[model samples]
Target chain A: MGTGTGLGRVRGLGSAKKGAHHWWMQRLTAAGNLLLVSWFVISLVRLPNLSHAVVTDWLSSPLVAIAAIILVANVFWHLRLGLQVVLEDYVHNEASKLGLLVLLNFYAIGAAAVAIFSIAKIAFGSAA
Target chain B: MSRNHSRPLSPHLSHWKWGANMLVSILHRMTGVGLATVGGLLFAGWFFAAASGEESYACFLGLLTVESGAINIVGAILGIGLTWAFFTHLFNGLRHFVMDAGAGYELQTNRHWAIAVVAGGIIATLVLWGWLLWPAIMGLVGGEG
Candidate 1:
């Protein structure tokens, strides 16, 4: 193997893959979370009481239901992205970093799923 | 491999620009932790209010409202924390959007936008607090009659 050939290859090289999609998603989810969070806060403040029936009634509204779903999804997505960056920055051990990243993704997904399911049950089920 | 190993690796941390991106990164984590803590507290309050009787719920409301100045202080802290979290996340989210659209990559633009984020956060917090307090002020004056 000649050194000259390897040098030429290195000079012309780019990354083995692209990460634009991931970057785009991180931004998109952040934007979504921003909007959802504002709605969530305002809605919470507007709620007159914390009675079960009242809570359910508010959630059962079509607009509130949709916003809650989006809020849950975007929250989880943003959490995953933020945690991934923290892991990448602080964890030098590749194996550990990857493991934590996988775990974080699963946790975020599970939490969001549970939240959405609870909201749906409260909003659409007989409880409402 | 031997020759490559002889060269020292460049410091990864050194390349990061200690400006808007860094600030956003740190704020993201801070707000995340803040949200989690506040969310947990809110959830606990919900659970307590749900499980307990109306008396307990009334007590909770009392603490949130007609209590001593300490309660107001706590409320203010939470309100400010929440306001900062919201605005920081919002501005940084917008920054991410612009970056995604292939703008603001230049150094000067990046710094300019970073400063804007800081300013936006302050202004947003002030406006939100002002709005929230307006009702309280009206109530205070109205009650004096």
Candidate 2:
């Protein structure tokens, strides 16, 4: 059920060393997202209510917190990689491209950190 | 490569017949970018509000639905739109996974599956939303006491 092995077979353009690595990670994260996000949404829909207590209690569970953290990590990683390709595709100026890539990295890392920290805080009952 | 004056230029979309697969490809990219930006920011807001305390969490929830005066319309639209976008990316990504497996490559198969991805996303979004909001929808029809 891996995406990279199949994509790797069709890598005429993405066959370069770094390209292959990037391509592989993208597929890995994509697969991770498919599973993790499905879990997230299904659980969300099943929640009796989205009240603070209910949500906090849910996050307080070790398994939920751990999965949330991993989901955030994988999501942001996939996002950064995918957006990198888009920026590299549309924004051709060397300076602009480099600047944007840096900005993208910062955004992905910063946002993921904030979300993960928030989830951890809830998991620890600090936000209660 | 040399350019020739008044010669036929490189053909683009206008020169080719439009197909469902083409739309599917474009939509997959669009939905990916949209889901990442809009869905990511919205999720960040929800998580931050949750971590900030109950008051913040309630405020966020209020704004998300019709309970508050703030951003309800925008929030409601985004709720459904992001759901659709998310489903679109999910189905289309699945389509890629199948293609990666060296199946569904026939012209008709490709086009039908492309159409299926598009249609499947819409159907799934509707189904999920319909189920979740069934009570609210029923209430609107005075089905609730």
Which one wins on DockQ?
Answer: 2
lDDT of 2 by residue, A86-108 (tens): 99988878899999999989988
- State the local distance difference test value for candidate 2: 0.86
**Model 1 per-residue lDDT tens digits across residues A1-128:** 44664566567567657567667677787777667777777887688755555666776777887788777778777667766777787888889988988887777776676667766665565342
Q: Which candidate's TM-score is highest?
A: 2
Q: Report per-candidate DockQ.
A: 0.22, 0.59
Instruction: Report the backbone clash tally of model 1.
Output: 0
TM-score against truth, every candidate: 0.68, 0.86
